[model samples]
Target: MNIVIVGAGLAGVSAAEELRNQGCPGQITLIGAEPHAPYERPPLSKGILLGDAEPDSTIVHDAQWYADHEVELITGVPVSEVDIDTGHVLLGDRHLPYDRLLLTTGSVPRRFPLADRSGADVVYLRTLDDALALKSRLTENLLIIGAGWIGLEVAAAARTAGGTVTVVEAADLPLAGVLGPELAPVFVDLHREHGVDLRLGTSVTAIEQRGGRTLVMLADGHQVSPDLILVGIGAEPDDHLAVKAGLDTDGGVLVDAWLRASDPHVYAAGDVANQEHPVLGRIRVEHWDTAIHQGRHAARNMLGQDDPYDRQPYFFTDQYDLGMEYVGHVGPEGYDEVVVRGELDDRVVTALWIRDNRVLAGMHLNDWDAIDPIRSWVGREADEELRNTASRLCPR
Candidate 1:
């Protein structure tokens, strides 16, 4: 049994490890576009940008580890073509045959056309190289467009490093699309209190280079000049490979509950695979936890185990003094009322999104121990008795 995993990020790396764990003695090839070894990405926006972590600390595994495992690690070389008909992956003129192929192509940051047209040097935070470049300019004045996770996270890191950070968003609150109205305010308040100039309900009209700085013109007719412009609007799946290979793609590579693509021998995971989840419907998650678990699940199915990837969505963030872990999935209009187990003013709280008295999702704001109960509550009725079980579930 020969397996080839492309886009050697977390998902690909995790799948490779799981294949070996499953006792597969076949050839395992992991191909990556980055010249460096397979590395972690979460730290790019956090510790790495804050100057607390070394450049090489994010490396998931060194070359010797792959060599010992007998997994072919191809770095810095891009796969030119994936010939599903011939069961071969073409690297330039060379080709490697595979019995199974897993794609973890991941996502790329959404570009800002306004800034791009202006010819100003605008940066994005998706790769380690991008993080390192932003880290060097931490203390400089930054104009950040968009209030999504990446943008907000970069804003927090810049502020912590003594930089003047201004975050602009068209929405009324940051993460409004993800957290919804009931809990979105928590993030807005957190960043505002931390000295971040958050321009909510605003949009950037234009950006132009003014001498050594960039002057940003806003939709409100206001203008500000900054040393650097960083855009973190959001990210889109890098699924061109799947599309080119004649596989089903809708924003991302479409996969079934088993994490297998339209083609039986090929599968996809992580940010690039949009799976029709049995429990959660058609959902695509771009978090670190999803990447790891999805990779493992894909490996199991590849090994002849028929299991559906029904794990709940999970993501975490840390901004200033606030830390949070959000579990379960709730679309923008999925939830009606939000029940708070603790006070938001205190910052230690458990917020549950409820629709028709059923918990759609939940989050722990500075309350670390509430995640277990929160996870259990999802898809269950959020009655008075059930909502009160938070304290009993986790006493600490």
Candidate 2:
């Protein structure tokens, strides 16, 4: 039985490892579009961009590991099509038949429209090579197009490197839509305090290149020339292969609670899978933790375990002296109220989101020890007794 897995990121490598651990004696082929081995992406914008870590250090498994495990590792190639009828993946003229197929094909950054048309050399951080290139360019004054997590992390890194950064965000607050009004200001203040020129409630009308310098024209009639422009707005699921194969996709490949796609024979995990969460309905997470765990779970389901993927969404970020872990997910339905513990000024904060009297999400910013209790509180009642949790869960 040959198992062909498309995508060689964290999820794909994880699924390959799990398949071997599960005692699958047949063939296992892992294909990646990037030439490099599977590596952790979290360090790209943080440690890699900051020049604190080497790119090769991020690799999950060296060549020796793959050879020792007898796993077929294919790099620098992409599977152009998935012939569902034939149960094979097409790579140019080659067709690899698979007893089971898993797609951990992550996501691609959303391209900036103005940057492309204006002939401006804008940077987007997604791959290992991208980070290295952006690292060299960080020596220049940077203009960021978005105030999302990636944008902010890069801004923090740039500021720490003594480079000027101007962030233009359409939203009134950085991450206002995701963190809500209560917690978004924490990031805004963090950047402003570090000398980030944050222009909130602003949008870029055009990007122009003048005399070998890039100028960004804003909605408010302000034009600024910067050495580099980076777009970190967000990403979209890379579901072209799945969609071309005629699978159901809503922003991503639609999968059941078990991570099986429209066709039971095909499975998807990681950023590409719009999985059915038992507790949160349908959701797609692009975080590192989600990708790792979902790969393992999807592998089990591929082995016919038929277990539901019910893990809560989890992600973390590090910038300057700040570190945060966010558990649970806030979808389009939103949350009703937020309870704050500790003060943002002190740099140790915890926040809980409640809706219909039930805690829906929780976060610990620079309060690393609060996650266990925060996890317990989420999906539980936010009654009068729990409302007093601020005192109990305050950072030590």
Best by TM-score: 2
Q: Number of clashes in model 1? A: 0
Model 1 lDDT per residue over 1-396, tens place: 999999999999999999999998999999998887888888898889877789789998887889889999998998988989999999877899999999998999888888878877688888888888889998988989999888888899999999998889999888887777867888888888988989988899877776677788988777878888999888999998889999999989999999999999999999999999997789999999999999999988998999999999999988777888988888645777777666767778887787878888888988777788788889898776886686454333
TM-scores of the models, in the order given: 0.97, 0.97
What digit string (tens of lDDT, one per residue) describes model 2 on residues 1-396? 688999999999999999889988889999999999999999999999999999889999999999988799999999999988889999878999998999999999999887867877788999999999998888688999999989999998999888999999999998887799888888888899999999999999988788987888999888989888898989999999999999899999999999999887899999999988999999999999999999999888888787899999988899888999998987888988888888778879889898998988999888878888888888999987787765577832
Candidates in order have lDDT scores of 0.88, 0.90
Lowest summed lDDT across 10 adjacent residues in model 2 is found at 387-396
RMSD of each: 1.7, 1.4
- Which residues of candidate 2, in runs, are more than 4 Å off? none
Displacement of residue 36 (Cα, Å) in model 1 is 1.6
